[model samples]
Target chain A: MKNFSRFTLLSLLFLYLFFGNCIVGNFSSVYAQDDWKQEYSSVCAKTQNAMILTPEELKSYIDRCDKLLALINELEGEQAATEKKVYTKRVKMCRELYQFALEYKEHK
Target chain B: MAPIQKLLSAFIIALTVPVSASAADYSHYLRHIPPAENFGQVVLDNYSHKAGVLPVTFDHWLHRAKFTCRLCHIDIGFAMKAEMTEISAADNMSGYYCGACHDGKRVFDGRNIFGSCAENYTEDEGKRCARCHSSAEAEERKYDYKSFSEKLPKLPGNLIDWEKAESEGKVKLTDFLEGVSYKREPLKAQDDFTIKIRSWDVIFSHRKHTVWNGCELCHPMIFPSTKRGTTKYSMFQIMMKGEYCGVCHTSVAFSVWLCAKCHITLVE
Candidate 1:
């Protein structure tokens, strides 16, 4: 009876640790994804608001796109087909937009 | 007993819980270059194959060499999409669609052009039907795209640098058609503006686009010119082969991949 109770206790403790770690890991990943999405939305809004961008505004825009591109690259491997497409598109847009900004600044 | 039951239920739940998993393979359609002769050619098979008729092959390179895009797409009221116009034998016979130019009465280069798709034809006349109905392999074209493009000045890519050719007076595009287009005072093009798309500023050149397209070509059709910010378009939509800019950029004109062309501005 004592051995059975000890086994039960060890099993319960092992399950608690295992499931606890899993839940924490899942929550953290979800949180990280939400943060990345918020950052993307904020940068996209700022970009759209600027009609004729000043040099500083353009630089900020380029910087944001670069940051977003990095995040997209990091997330792309884990993404589904549809999510990967969206990320790939964002990456292209970011790269092109960054290049455009650099050229405009040089010409200006 | 209750504690053991709870542990068993918990293990079962853990094992059955769904994980965020997906198949890793992902791909997007990339445009491929067709042979010079077949570059702008399209095979219309909407109702043709269903009705047991061979698909109609329309060549943009052949027609665009003689007439402007506006002449066929705007003035003649042909839809940008193939087979969307629902062209019929009766419609052509009534001097509409292809009949407008292919009536045989219309003189081109001081010679009468042959009539197209007549309803009634003798065995001898039926032989002429093969000219258009012929498959891509069987068609004997009068003009060669390579020879025609070679005579004009060269561009970087395989496609003809139409904008440069037009600017250098190598090719002159006619904007009007008799009995089709109405004469009106041309509106002055709007000043160029920088459209902020994502983190980049794309310089929208009104003067450059208007040179070949004119007002009617884009107005109220591909774009609504009457209102500002009324139509919202995205690069994602364009990349997905949606309308607006992709109509020309993906197929005929310089591709969207050439970033420096439109996105001329830079950040200091």
Candidate 2:
């Protein structure tokens, strides 16, 4: 009887380890990851509020950003020929504007 | 004495349980890739009550026939996993969710789509609701799996090969939904470039993605707007079934084994 008890305890321990590990892995796969809204501040909520735009407006924002990026890439090739400091400042401004459009799309 | 018998019984029960469960075919019906029927129906039935009614069904086969899965799941706004999206009737009624497609004028049966939301409810309206929530019904088994799938256009490769069909001009997705879209000129396609993978020498083609996904798919969601490199992802996670690129790779699209398509230069 005593031997049987010992065997029982050993079996339970093995079961616990095996089942416990499976459960942990399964749960992690199902819900372990997080999304942007959950991780980021409610600033996203604020951005979505008040203003409403059609899909066209949203696409236009994406287009504007792409054009800006293209222009920046083009200017980088000509940095030596152009006025150094002024061109650099203009590039920075364009990049910043591009980011604004990007953020607007996200917030939308 | 009595307690000892109880412990012994418990041990025997536990030992048998795993063996029995393992013998049962939990995934028997899901062997070969099931065609993209309204999989969301079964998915919602299995999980929705615990989650919410927003477990609205999204049929991939029907939509992919006309539009690419990338248009909705990738572009419009949808989570790859069923019941994961935080959908609401208000969102749909306000031109979100199912309303994105069900809008009355754009396509068929769009007006009656407002059934998901109404100030008052009745017994008859529940019938229309079953159009989506049909998994629990007795008639569900009536949908002959073989017959229904055979009727639908075979996906050529995976039942969800959106890019292949779209590039062939088989699918024409309406990027601009009337009443939903304001108005904007079409954006020019950017020259395709390789997104060099870290560690792995995989090359992701922007052109390939655009063929199916168009620009809207990747722009604000997967990569996010403006915050470059913010979304950290791993091939392992995707393989293990964390949606993203895996939603297709594991189930439908191309198997991950075709790594050379994405993964480039192998270190000699």
Candidate 3:
């Protein structure tokens, strides 16, 4: 009786772990992308205001763009192709503009 | 005229125009200039035909006459290529792009600019919709290109001398929009530099171009490289093909046939 109880407890524990991971993975696929999409929108949204940014601020965004670009590049599957292309170009445009602003602030 | 027709005309000119035997024969690079009425007309039809509405005939001169190029291109996030922006009516109705100005609440020149789009419209509002979605050959236009160009300085091909028009303040350009644009220090003007060509080294004026383009329009996109001598441009690319300076000069800014404008070193 003691052995049966222990065996049942172990099986339940394994089952819980398996189902929990499946639920979490599914949730991540749906919700995880929103975080980056929001981040991208906010990051690139400030292009109109770039000239007003301080050198430090510009540098931070440039760094942020580079980091986002790296993670975005690592995104796999054909579904990610459009996102990868659009995001990569948008990020690069924002990054280059930020870099240009930094240089302008320093030189001019 | 359509972009296709422009290309065909340029090709025909390239074939017919006599190749210059000497440096002075700049006629080799001349292109056919569209008349004033049709010069800068852009048809926005990305979703128009499918939506059962006529394509919006966007007159570049009408808008650019009052607003800076940067206002539309950078701040408004409009793509340079026509129909490339993929502007949907839904986007406009949400107070983005054209809706940024055309919200119908914002007062420009003490008159309310009509709202760009709406989810539903009464019979009266139908007229407002027709303002943009008019037929291609629609004669009823609030701003006629011919009358508008009359006061502005004229170029060889009857194009508006935009540089002169701005310099003289004949047309005052609004560079900043209230909510959409933020206040910032003006760009410290960059020095004019010469772009070397074989027959004539072109003296490119940064100060002149900056007035209309601001900084964002050209930098890192059209002319990506900051380093001098990095980007090589041939007349073949400029006159016959849409690359480098041809991006604007061939279509909007001025004709490359006005060689004396850029190739000023030899002419002077």
Candidate 4:
């Protein structure tokens, strides 16, 4: 009886350990994804107004894009590949846009 | 004395005769214009064939008729060229890309916009799959470009006069999405500028372009330099080689063949 009870406890503990990690992992990933998405959206959203930004401001944006791109590339999971590709392309485009504005400002 | 008089008359005639740019000859620059329905249509086969379905056909005309260029390119982050987006069924079901709008629950034009990808659809629901995957059936499509475009303003060639249609309130373009796009101040368009060449001086309008493109579409991607006269490309480049203005005009816009549209001021 004691052995059977111990087995039940062991099985319950095993299931809890397995699913608990999964649930926690999934929630952490969701928050991580939201963090990067928010960063990406905020960074790329400024591209339309790039022309009006100062050269210093444009340079700063370029730095932000590069950093965000790195974060996107470092991501891993089921949807990581698609998310990485999407965010990488967008962040690079944003970086290029900022660089273009910086060059225009410097020339003037 | 007669010979000199003839020369003077010829010079006078040349000066008086307005340099009439061939308006109807926009087709000269195009290899072949797609039929009105096929215009701006792109079929993406990224993972469709791998997943045992026909390629998805995205008709830009229908989408652009309702949404602004910035909403997709800037807000949603859709790549400009074909197959560059690499969309997947999983991505759509997870609420990215096409899922942003076609979430099945969202209503448009008084009806629910069809969802892009679902978790599990039976074989009987193949009709729903065929909507975007392309069944080659006309009835499956909700919107018909021919009848819809018939009411809109016509350009010189097969293209629709989208600018006129929007300006006259025939079509109201939506520039914002609820969650995807950040709410911000409307763009303040710069004034018009003239690009002087040896032959025709082109009159470029920022206000007109901003209405459709919202600045980022051309800036940095098409035109690296925003300043006046900094970025230079000749007619040889645009018309013959398909560069600069030819990029959009050749494929989607009014086209580079319509010379009078841009080269309004003649240099001679």
TM-scores, all models, native as reference: 0.56, 0.47, 0.71, 0.79
Chain A, candidate 1, TM-score of: 0.57
Q: Write model 1 residue lDDT over A27-57, tens digit each, in one string.
A: 9888888777666545543322232456677
Note the residue pairs that clash in candidate 2.
B201-B264, B202-B263
Per-residue CA lDDT of candidate 1, range B177-207, in tens?
Answer: 6654434344456578777755446888877
Q: Is the docking of candidate 3 incorrect, acceptable, medium or high quality?
A: incorrect
Question: Using DockQ as the measure, what is the rank order of every candidate, best first?
Answer: 4, 3, 2, 1
Relative to the unseen true structure, what is the C-alpha lDDT of residue B36 in candidate 1, on a scale of 0 to 100? 50
lDDT of each: 0.58, 0.45, 0.74, 0.74
TM-score of the second chain for every model: 0.75, 0.57, 0.86, 0.82
DockQ of candidates 1 onward, in order?
0.01, 0.02, 0.09, 0.27
lDDT of 4 by residue, A1-108 (tens): 999999999999999899998999989888988998788778777766777888888888888888888888899887787677666766777788788778878877
The runs of at least 3 residues in candidate 1 whose Cα sits more than 4 Å from the true structure, single-residue gaps closed, are A1-108, B1-36, B46-53, B225-232, B265-268
Candidate 1 DockQ, CA atoms: 0.01
Pairs that collide in candidate 1 are: A101-B266, A101-B267, A102-B266, A103-B265, A103-B266, A104-B265, A104-B266, A105-B266, A105-B267
Per-residue lDDT of B1-268 in model 3, one digit per residue for the tens? Answer: 4566556666754564455434345444434666766766778999989998888888877787889887777656677778887777876776667887989898887899889888898988877877788854565457777788899997776788888898898988888887555454556667799877655678889888777676667766787655568665555666667667887786678777777788776565
Which candidate leads the pack in lDDT? 4
For all candidates, what are the clash counts? 9, 2, 0, 0
DockQ of 3: 0.09
Name the best candidate (by DockQ). 4
